[model samples]
Target: MAKTILVVDDSASLRQVVGIALRGAGYDVIEACDGQDALNKLTGQKVHLMISDVNMPNMDGISFVKAVKQRPAYRFTPIVMLTTESQESKKAEGQAAGAKAWVVKPFRPEQMLGVVQKLVLP
Candidate 1:
């Protein structure tokens, strides 16, 4: 079966782009408008990986990652922060929150796919 990836971002266009890329790479994609929406989508489902944006309206990526880590069912799920923020402090914060990788925006589809393949649960 294909790995399922949950993508959380406030931008519809960004989600669409990521969805297309993942689909093309033979992975299934679930999209959420923000952190809260992503959490709601995770109910009793198996998500192989997650890609989230750092800044959002309802909840930020770091907080979202922290929330996921607190959940026993999802604590081991790999999360990647896809955002514009490149600051060391922000990256450290994401790491502290349990994100496995960081991908800056304007990313190449190939690069994102590479990371996903490496991190997605088998």
Candidate 2:
């Protein structure tokens, strides 16, 4: 079975782009507009990975990562922050929140897929 990825971002276009790329790469995708929606979509499902944006209307990526860690079922699930913020401080914050990797926005599909491949377990 293909791995399932949850992508959280406020931009619909961004989500679409990432979804297409993930699906094309033979992964299943679940999209959410922000952290709250992403949490709702969790539903104790088997999400192999997560890609989230930093700045959003409801809960942000860092906070979302923290919340995800609190859940026993998803505590070890890998997360990658995909955002426009490239600051070292912000990256540190995401790392502290348990994100395993970071990918900046306007990313090439192949680049994102490479990281996903590294993080997603077989």
Candidate 3:
């Protein structure tokens, strides 16, 4: 079966663009507008990987990652943060929250796909 990926972002355009890229790379993509929405979706679906944007309305990605990690079922799920912020502090926070990788905004499809392939199921 194809790997399932949950993509959380506030920008509709970014969600569309990334969703297309992930689908092109053979992943089944699920989208959420923000952290709370992502949590709701998580309960309803089976996801293999997560790609999230840090600064979002209503609960933000950092808090979302922490919440996901708290859940035993999602503790080890591979997560990557996609955002414009390149601050080491933000990266450190994400790492501390259990993100497996980080991708800056304006991500290339090939680069994003590479990480997805490495982290998600083959």
Candidate 4:
């Protein structure tokens, strides 16, 4: 079965772009507008991986990562922070919160796919 991925970002266009790439690569996608929405989606099913943006309304990606780690069901689900922020401080903060990989914004589709492949085990 195709692995499912939860994509959390406030930009609808960005979600659609990433969703298209993921779907083309044979992964199922669940999209959420922000950290809160992503947390809400987590309860439904097994998400093999997560791609999130750092700056979002209600809750940001770092906080989201912390929250996800606290949940027993989704504790080990690998997360990739796909955001515009490239500061070491922000990356360290995300790393501390339990994110596995970090991908900066304006990324190529194949680059994103490669990161997904490495993290999402079949």
Off by over 4 Å in 4: none
Q: What residue pairs clash in candidate 3, if any at all? A: none
TM-score of every candidate relative to the true structure = 0.98, 0.98, 0.95, 0.98
List candidate 1 segments past 4 Å from native.
Answer: none
RMSD from true fold, candidate 3: 1.1
Candidate 2: list runs displaced more than 4 Å: none
* Each prediction's whole-model lDDT (CA): 0.95, 0.96, 0.91, 0.95
Which predicted model would earn the best lDDT? 2
Residue 98, candidate 3: Cα error in Å is 0.6
lDDT of 4 by residue, 1-122 (tens): 99999999999999999999999999999999999999988875888999999999999999999999999988989999999999999999999999999999999999999999999855
Give the range where candidate 3 is weakest over 10 consecutive residues by summed lDDT. 39-48
State the lDDT of candidate 2 residue by residue for 27-95, as single tens digits: 999999999999999999899999999999989999999999999989999999999999999999999
Lowest lDDT block of 10, candidate 2: 113-122
